[model samples]
Target: MRIIISPAKKMRVDTDTLAWHDLPCMIDRAEVLYDKLASMSYDELKRLWKCNDAIAALNVERLHNSDLRIRLTPAILSYEGIQYQYMAPGVFTDEQLIYVQEHLRILSGLYGVVRPFDGVTPYRLEMQAKLPIEGAKDLYGFWGSAIADQLYQETDCIINLASKEYSVCVSRHQKPGTRFITCVFGEEKDGKVVEKGTLCKMARGEMVRYLAEANAKSPEAMKDFACLNYVFSPAHSDESTYVFLQKKSQDSEE
Candidate 1:
């Protein structure tokens, strides 16, 4: 069993070596996207969505375990202008937060707001939750109820459950304005290996299909599992959809 926490070569936010203009430009880019989407026609919006999806796939290529299933949408605004909407990893709760903190207390990196320099940490209040063995329905219920009230405007990102017992994770790190992918793999325990894989390119419609399969009572292929993985399903990119995992690799003999 081997556990590895490998940093993405090009994360959503690579702060340590960041240039002075990086953060500002990144923020501006998000807002600019908001503005562009502010008045986008229906057809134009659809085009934008497809383009964003393509970009997400391209970005995922640089990292071993980043979420390729994440989505970027033309974020509608209230009194303001248009913004970006991240459909995946969208919901949260406080109990989930506490549980995440407790679970990641040992790993430390899994809890807390990413430091100013931790560009890769993405959104503030990044935390990890363990998948309850009870069942998927019960798990989401606990999570939705837990963070529903507490995660009002302050909270940013959440790292859902990973399949490996007590040793792995799949996350979505919120970026400055809108977000696409901010992923991480936490500590690995003995005899466990987190295998790295990804779904290179996908469309929103395709993602929806994969999600359906992933969440089925049982998935036949990694693609089906990818869709079901969600923000907290304890899984990553798969071909049926998009699922990445940090698991202990078995020998060829196995």
Candidate 2:
């Protein structure tokens, strides 16, 4: 499991920097961090230890831990003000992998839980989930503020539907299986997330149906907030407008 990111043949700032891959490098550090995994412990092996909500317990700093020896060196990492961090697969275990996957779902507000057998995941767990496609980026600060006060507080829900005039935004670029998960909340009538293992699959015709049905009921989405208002690549474009995705891109990490 030893991982070493061989630097490419260019001045990556200093010709000495390369980001670590999570797999081999992570495996290399397995012996050292193995003890930190709950499942490796005597008392918690078989039990799913309900962890501290997603962001709170993340060991981001652990990436820079000493034994594994990760260094950014002098790489020209930022381009146009975008910063990137390297991930090495240090000490990754099956339990930790599962926990990390679930952690992503919780943060992204996607499915109720992460499932593998749905055919898109790396592992084969037969689960699926859905996401709320609200103004996702705008809600990040809100989520942060909510977490600052109290994490995962069950709160109110607001339903967002498309307007009637623009029923569907089709694209030749639109590939199948495009999906996302975003935070959703509402009163108990909208379905409270009391269980930790629910999957909501809104792909293919199901996704088309949901949006179409929603649009027929609400006009504001199609009329006021067409795809051009945001930043991500839109499904299509038209006169005086360009679309941007309000949800996570297809390239986003799970």
Candidate 3:
């Protein structure tokens, strides 16, 4: 099974941690995107990124100077978001690292889909960003079925840990017969399942680590995940969705 996750908006360059094994599969396409972004003015890019001036300025500098092919960090190590922090791939054992290298795929707006150890430079673009390319209306349209098609080629079963923005790129164009399962981390609120953004990110990261350690080979194996006070809810889960609800703490129970 291939596991899919989203790219974090926050990133850093860490060429010293672990060497990148390969360039992203869609490097040529990424170059096309890079050139487009590189050509845009700082103000234009700032609007596209939808960020504060400081962030926009930083990325504008990165776009101008950072070479995508040179001095790259592994995709897993580059992202500095909470999810990556919890995944903590930097401390993984050789076996666990190997497992993730084989199964983990990071979905990116600029790179389409990248392997865990794929070489990448820090850049700012979100899957939902409205940067029109060629004849496509948005990044999603630009990616088309490319992400799903590539994932289908790797495995018939895909375990989606990505947020909806990135996951939609694959879900909308999955090949027939492919089994796509989404893992939801949430709490039971007012007798309904409610997912909060930060908690879900933490859970997703923890789940990646759990799967790597377990060397999970099947979707059924995922049901065994227990972390961050979450337990699988059979009542809320179906074939395509696995819902894990947070259990109240002892203090709260008292």
Q: Say which candidate scores most in lDDT.
A: 3
What's the ranking of the predictions by TM-score, best on top?
Answer: 3, 1, 2
lDDT of 2 by residue, 41-106 (tens): 323321222333342223222322323223322211211111111111123344433332222111
Per-residue accuracy of model 3 over 160-240 as CA lDDT, tens digit each: 999999999999998888899999999998889999999999999999999999988898988888899999999999999
Off by over 4 Å in 1: 1-32, 51-196, 199-251
Q: Which runs in model 3 stand beyond 4 Å of their true positions?
A: none
Alpha carbon deviation, residue 4, candidate 2 (Å): 35
* TM values, all candidates: 0.19, 0.18, 0.98
> Cα deviation in Å at residue 16, candidate 3?
1.2
Of the two candidates 1 and 2, the one with more favorable TM-score, higher being better, is 1
Who wins the TM-score comparison? 3
Q: Which stretches of candidate 2 lie over 4 Å from their true place?
A: 1-43, 49-199, 203-254
**Taking the tens digit of each residue's C-alpha lDDT, what string does model 1 give over 215-244?**
322222223333212221244333222333
**Per-model CA lDDT versus the true structure:** 0.25, 0.22, 0.93
Write down the TM-score for model 2.
0.18
